[model samples]
Target: MEAHRIFFERPFDYKYAREYSGTLMTPTLWITAAYVILVFGTKAYMKDRKPFDLRRPLQLWNLGLALYSGAAFLIATKEILSTWFNKGLTATYTDINSFYEGTCGAWAYLFMISKYYELGDTAFLVLRKRPLLLMHWLHHLTTLNLVLAGYHYDTHLYSWLLWMNTFIHTLMYSYYLLASCGYRLPAGFAKKITTMQIIQFCIGLSILAHIGVLKLFTDREVHCNWRMWWGTVFMEILYLTLFSHFYYVSYIKDGGKKFVRDQNEKKQVKAQ
Candidate 1:
């Protein structure tokens, strides 16, 4: 029991550091292997059984998302308010490295560790036989890498990205929670959620690019925290591209057109 407590409770300790790094590789590989096996195994094992009912699991997922988003929001708000009002914006803004390492360091480490917990999201998708898009898995896998790299470098600029992501996730996960509870939000709101994600990526990319430029041209001896900067920029670009494709396919392509046509047909039938 003590060993279990140490393993599960104190995951952030350096003695267990390799476990954190191993998370970047192990979860994705295990998830992928499990998915492939299940895809094939399900065909043989439950050919006649009814399809899996995902409602309960989805609700659990929604609850998890709510908790994660709430924690993220609280962390971001605490950092922002303390930095902005108490310490002055310029000082807080300029010295992000110090802020993260000193004030919010432990929380950031906790959040980073939580990424491993989130691997369960993909596990549910596989269990439900949901199509595992490359973007989905890539996002999960690379995010683990990003968090690990960010901690290693202790990058200051990452705070802004974390803050913005926390805000967006509050909405994103709330939407998921509502949907899981069988509440149908407006179609416009769904579109807005996608738009918010896109905007997050755009803002994140711009910030990293700005820092990169500053490193290039300025006389100021800017700290080149390459791990955080490059990892974030690369991931943001990938997210932007992947989400743009998903949006186009979901809202503009042949599938989207067919969906609209079907809705119109149903409406006409009801009118009759």
Candidate 2:
């Protein structure tokens, strides 16, 4: 199949200057550098300043996340629609790759840069004197790195993962935004969002597993870069572990009753 042939043939243009040019490496380097400088600088400045005002920055962050989620939804919907109508995964992959090669590629790069923007979420926590959770920082840093690596390797599964995450982040960030605005959604709904993230990771793992199976079992010409495959697998495993831990800490541990009681008490204090 032509689709299988394209998959087997390395998608990268081998000309070093050409392929690596317009890739994520240069921009990611610059963004990561800027983020480090900005975050540390802001942290230092906040040491002598009044408590960080959560209202303004949180509003801005919410808006940014909403826009990003919207974009992801569009991309994912397009891919799913194409796949449904075309009657096969191969065609869907090819069409999506073409989109990536053209416009989606640039958008992905922009999203990679946005990871640096997201570091401000932590800066906000620091300024507000909120305790920084290890999972939060790990997610931010590793997610940025994953985006960089995904682009560098041009992993075929990346498009699918991106599509799913965009959908998930749309919900997750929207919730954060709303909660920051002092709107209390149902606790169960919030928990479900985290659950959805865990599921997303699971789905991503499945895609990687499917690709591995294809390579192992069949004479199919499907080819995947080993680095990309393992990078994705490792990252997904890390995410699963972290998110699962978060779920346990937030909901399941201590019978979850204590957790809810504490949350309600906090809410009452906030209201008072």
Candidate 3:
């Protein structure tokens, strides 16, 4: 019992978190609108100015997020394992208590709210004059929308999303943290991260399918709330398609040509 308490400590009011999620839905939409405008506005404002050298601040920002994601992953892992062992595999997805109770609940709420803070990633790109891809902003927007809807509807299926996202982000932000600090990471590192993101979306859809099967064939009460289910399905399919196209264009097609050309130039220089 003492050992269990260590892993399942409830430090926050879960009911209040749910209430807050419901109340914040409209405000979140408003904030997202403001975010879109600000992103384009910042880009226009910076068009005539030299890019700000924000390396140090960017390093600190990535470091902070890396740490947060790492910690969230650990907490989520413990909660997931505990539920799986004690309640069974189905409980991991169907248990609303798992979503709104104990340490996991608190961390999940933090994870949902973190979406708002993550808009800063785009701000960094805009201010630094980096090429902002559609995938980047669309990802932020869709994700914020999905998580808020999931929380408001108590979509327990999102427990899987919360866990998987935190795990991927732990790696993703750490990569950013290293690259920001002047580390010469492998050329394929970013490509590999994008590949992993593509894989993540595929796995998410697979989990949704698994829940769908259970709902259709079994009498077991599945919490596959349709309110968020269709939205989740649409977003996951869209992400998978977008990320796959990005990988093909950036790595397998144009990027492959660029890499080979750069390599040949290096070899010619060495030979001379």
C-alpha RMSD (angstroms) for model 2? 6.7
Q: In model 3, how large is the Cα lDDT of residue 98? A: 64
- Among these predictions, the greatest TM-score belongs to 3
* Model with the higher lDDT, candidate 2 or 3: 3
The best-first sequence of candidates by lDDT reads 3, 2, 1
Query: Which rank order by TM-score, best down to worst?
Result: 3, 2, 1
> How close is each model in CA RMSD to the real structure?
5.4, 6.7, 5.7
TM-score of 3: 0.88
- Model 3 scores a C-alpha lDDT of 0.80
TM of each candidate vs. truth? 0.73, 0.79, 0.88
**lDDT tens readout by residue for model 1, 103-177:** 355556656666666666766666655456777777776776676666545556656666766677678777877
Q: Tell me the tens digit of each residue's lDDT in model 3 across 1-272.
A: 12233235456666566666787788888998998999999999999998888889999999888898999889888877888989887788776576557666777888888999999999899998877889899999889978987876777877878888888888889988887776756777777788888888988898788788877788878766765777889999999988888777767896487556644563554355
Candidate no. 2 TM-score: 0.79
Candidate 1: which stretches are off by over 4 Å? 1-49, 85-94, 98-103, 219-224, 258-272
C-alpha lDDT score of every prediction, in listed order? 0.64, 0.69, 0.80
Could you tell which candidate, 1 or 3, scores higher by lDDT? 3
Model 2 weakest 10-residue run by lDDT:
1-10
Write out the backbone clash pairs for model 3. none
